[model samples]
Target: MVSQTSHVYRYRVDAEDTIVAVDEWWLAFAKENNSLDLDEASVVGKSLWSFIADHATQKLYKEIHRFVRVTGNPITVPFRCDSPTLRRYMQLTITRHDKQHLDYESVLLRAVPSRRLALLDPIQQRSAAFLTMCSFCKRSLIEPSGWLEIENIAIKLRLYREQTVPEIRYTVCPDCEDHFGSNRQKLESSSEQPPR
Candidate 1:
């Protein structure tokens, strides 16, 4: 079980996506959630986007962030991403605001549930079955959050607690599959280009 982290990832980053300020409490949170071996020094001044390790998560964030930057609006969503040190879940709240006094336009990111907590789902089925999971990220299909960690499948599906891990059938997740199709098209188009 991961220790509940102290800091809640409430930080402000510039429009350029560079973190300009951070909370000291988050330092303690980083200590607890230390997955990617990051510290205060590593976080501040770094591109907020650099922290994401999951391709699917990165892709999703890119789209969401693009819209926020363009629209200057706020958004809140439950996003699962592998943190610096572990695979964890977080509730992300992003807001667009400008500090008139400082002449700064940036985004505020507030993260909740600083640790990876087990998800309990009420299930009527006791029998285990093959589950579809993401081929790349390994996040299984789970309720509420859609795709989550494979550990969650057993809990959500109510599989045998004493039994070994259930079998997982690999398939590209929807988001990644979409990106995969787009990437393949780009690759094909580039391949058709005359070698120049």
Candidate 2:
């Protein structure tokens, strides 16, 4: 049986961003999260882009990858990978292994019990309505205010009263985009050579 106590998950990708390898902990985490499709046989040899659901997040990741390869420096960033009942805070470090490969290491910073949110449950039934959720932070987009946490979204959107929750559509929020955008610009300017 895979250990749930393993807090570190790592994976390696080729220069083209094809998944080449994954640590056992990664498979264990996937299984724990009920993501059976992310098993080794299904994930390995697949393009990383295929796993990212939104274009904006993909674009940001591409920028980060380019920056790392060009500068030969690892980039570490904090992100949330929450489950229905747990709020998992994680840190990811992307290190260039060589000219042809890069390693991504994710360390679980912490996890706290959270109120069960149907919207976050993978097997939950969905209504025709859709909610735009930030891919990085997992916050739902509440118009006018933009992005808000699940708790606030629940009250503001009155999600608890619904018979079925809206389907979540992942996208990068403006805040996340701006944050990565500025970092990308800084990295590009600092790099002595442009990305190939």
Give the alpha carbon lDDT tens digit for every residue of 1-196 in model 1: 2323323556777767787776655555556544346676788888776865456556655555554554455545543444322454555566655631011122223333323322211122223555666744557776567987655554566543433344545555876566445434443344344422
Q: Highest lDDT, which number?
A: 2
**For model 1, the run of ten residues with the poorest summed lDDT:** 99-108
Pick out the ten consecutive residues of candidate 2 with the lowest summed lDDT.
Answer: 1-10
Candidate 2's error at 59, in angstroms?
A: 0.2
For model 2, how does the per-residue alpha-carbon lDDT over 29-55 read when each residue is reduced to its tens digit? 888887878899999999999999888
* Best-performing candidate as measured by TM-score: 2
RMSD in angstroms, all models? Answer: 11.2, 2.5
